[model samples]
Target: MPAPFTADTVTVHSPATSANLGPGYDSFGLALSRYDRVRARVRSAGLNVRVSGAGADELALDEAHLVVRAMRAAFDRIGAQPPGLELDCHNDIPHGRGMGSSAAAIVSGIELARSLSDDGRARLSDAEALALATELEGHPDNVAACLLGGLSISWLADGRGAAARAATAEQLAATGIRPVLFIPAEQSATRAARALLPEQVPHADAAFNAGRAGLLVLALTSRPDLLLTATEDRLHQGYRAAAMPASAALITALRSRGMAAVISGAGSSVLALALADQAGAAAELTPVGWECARLEVSSGARTSGA
Candidate 1:
């Protein structure tokens, strides 16, 4: 008879992530339509990796890769050597495009580790798994939205994920939120984008962001009708504009069209939209310098096709 689970492989699906949700800066984020895949199967006693898709041409599918690093760390947590392994990947999310491609890999890799702990099965509590995954991914924005689906408000401590302080799927579900993604043919280096900002902002700028930040939460939660009012940002967007070649043009175009958009995390990809009816035609605009993809916001990042 064939074994019920002979493969001894754990295939984890991770959704693509968009961090720094326009006004949220380090505080806000959303999952997106893109994705990547990771399949881990056990072998005798060595490690092997394979890669294909979006970033494959540039990414290392070996020990030096970020996913590999997270997997190894998970093994260390369990105090065991992961059996020889095969990791097959498909990278739908482009690298360095301000999308959470790397974070998804980290979360998927951690799931692989957790599976190894349960004698090759995944049995970690959702909360525990969430915390562990966030630690491996560094920060809660991407990991939180991916794990729980929908909108998540999480806190991280010492590089570990805290239980969601609050989750907003209920609120987000009450109304529809569509996303307009201006994916340029060119990708932005997250690190370079970060380098564009000053280590500190003037007090006035910081204070102004605080007020809008509050409005952002309210708009997303209790009153999405105010999304237009809520989308205004003070902290990261304007500052990042100087560095991101495409920022100003995209934001202006989106607003002129009555769409709500903000930099979806230190980005070149400007995520925005008005309503579902508008999304279809809006996607067709494709400004002179950008490639646009418009998708209504789903509760969480997508993984079925990853």
Candidate 2:
């Protein structure tokens, strides 16, 4: 097939993702409607990034940026010399809040590379994109969700384990899932949240997380009522409670009310998986100092131009 790029410019809209999804720590993810839009084109002889929205002033505008790094990685993988690039980033995903901003940026870059290169007369395939994005992000949860949309189940495995590091996404048949996000004013770094987890969890806790994670898949597919139980986590959240007390508190409060609430990705932002009909109910429970939004599951990444 001919490459998708026929002009100098390519634009990609990559969705922000919420990973972990409660008990499925580091393994499950869901792509939200929110996104970061990136536009790239051949320009000059150097890399330049222009940013607007979320991290405009704080994020770098040079080649060292995550987007540039990912684009370069994609080029290197395909044995193509990267071109002089101009990147425009209109970011809506919040930084350092476990909303997969980095993952979105990485996917954006990889898609940009695929759109720009045609050295082998081939465009990037979904598997190639996922593999490269996973390589750059070191995990597939968020990246897979950003690339494939809906819900993603990912794992890294040794030969003896379940499966080698791989990711896949699915669109659920059950459609009433309404995601209400409670984004706090303060941001929590993913690294800091991860540091709070112990090297290993208790065996029973692991079993509990495993069971709930399995149940979660079922609940998400058909039984909305089971979400409260399915979303229970005995793995990562409590260990990192101190890192984002407000998020922890909000989660507790919602769950106590029989709502399926969880810390989105890591912390600082909470997600209440409510039924579409219960959107107003979830909105009514939004706590102070947090921005709330009702979001749907995004179909997937969309690329256009050239």
Candidate 3:
């Protein structure tokens, strides 16, 4: 039999994530400082949900809510489910625009479920939790980084999600790397952006991305000078450029100014890997009506009141 719920309330703070990072498509991801906070409580008979901040107006308040769905999935995996749930979501990450908002929600839900169960941590190991989150999110890059923090490299192993942290928080802080984001008012859907790619890319382009992806690991961890070259990608960005013309043009312009820049994820947001001296210049390039923010690399999701 499964262990009963021991905690009446649980809170999870999940970080936003940026995937692809230019050349490591579907493999590399970085956690950003922005976060979404969810507080879940057990109830005797009814479900209640409240939302504030980003997506508050449009997001569903019932069982159809993404966080609720993820919590239910985690409860199923743990062999138990609470009678009812009350959720309070305070969101900071924007919806869509390739910022890993979905991944954050999924991660938060799984963590909440685990925290509420007396033996949930024992039943669901970290690897199992990650796999469950990946299953719910349909990809590992964003969820892996949101769960593990810093720089993460994820892949599929035996049809399950597997990930490892490439750069430690200390290493990243020492490099003084700042991620400057330029977010457009318009959002781009990941499905639409993915459909723009061809079934097969040229061998030469594949080789190019492989080389750059490897260099990206080194550049992000140690050699900051190589970032411009390391961030180069020919596999997916060009193919999806038409879907986010403004983003593509902004990346081109940033690179021309000797800064390392690339499309954040699928598109419509640009990420520039800037140093302390370069962050200001990168922000200045943000076009009118676009939102710009400079953020630091963040730690993984945190939980309280478990």
What value of lDDT does candidate 1 attain over all alpha carbons? 0.67
For candidate 1, the 10 contiguous residues with the lowest summed lDDT are: 297-306
Ranking by TM-score: 3, 2, 1
Per-residue error for 299 in candidate 3, Å, reads 0.8
TM agreement with the true structure for every prediction? 0.86, 0.91, 0.98
lDDT of each: 0.67, 0.81, 0.91
lDDT of 2 by residue, 1-306 (tens): 233233468899999888888998988888889999999886546777899999888998897889999988887776765547889999999898889999999989888888777642254566767877887887888888888788778766441101122222334525477888889888888888888889987899999999999899888877778999999998899898987888888888888878899999987799988887677877887777778988888866788885
Model 1, 161-253: lDDT tens per residue? 764524354456466666677777777877777777878888997777677767777776666667766777767778778777566677877
On residues 85-152, what C-alpha lDDT tens digit does candidate 3 reach at each position?
88999999988878899999999999998998878888888999999999988889999999999999
Record all residue pairs in model 2 with backbone atoms less than 3 Å apart, i.e. clashing. Answer: 6-306
Q: Which ten residues in a row have the lowest lDDT in candidate 2?
A: 159-168
> What is the clash count for each candidate, in the order shown?
2, 1, 0
**Candidate 1, TM-score vs. the true structure?**
0.86
Task: State residue 175's C-alpha deviation in candidate 1, in Å.
Answer: 0.8
Candidate 2 overall lDDT versus native: 0.81
lDDT of 2 at 296: 80
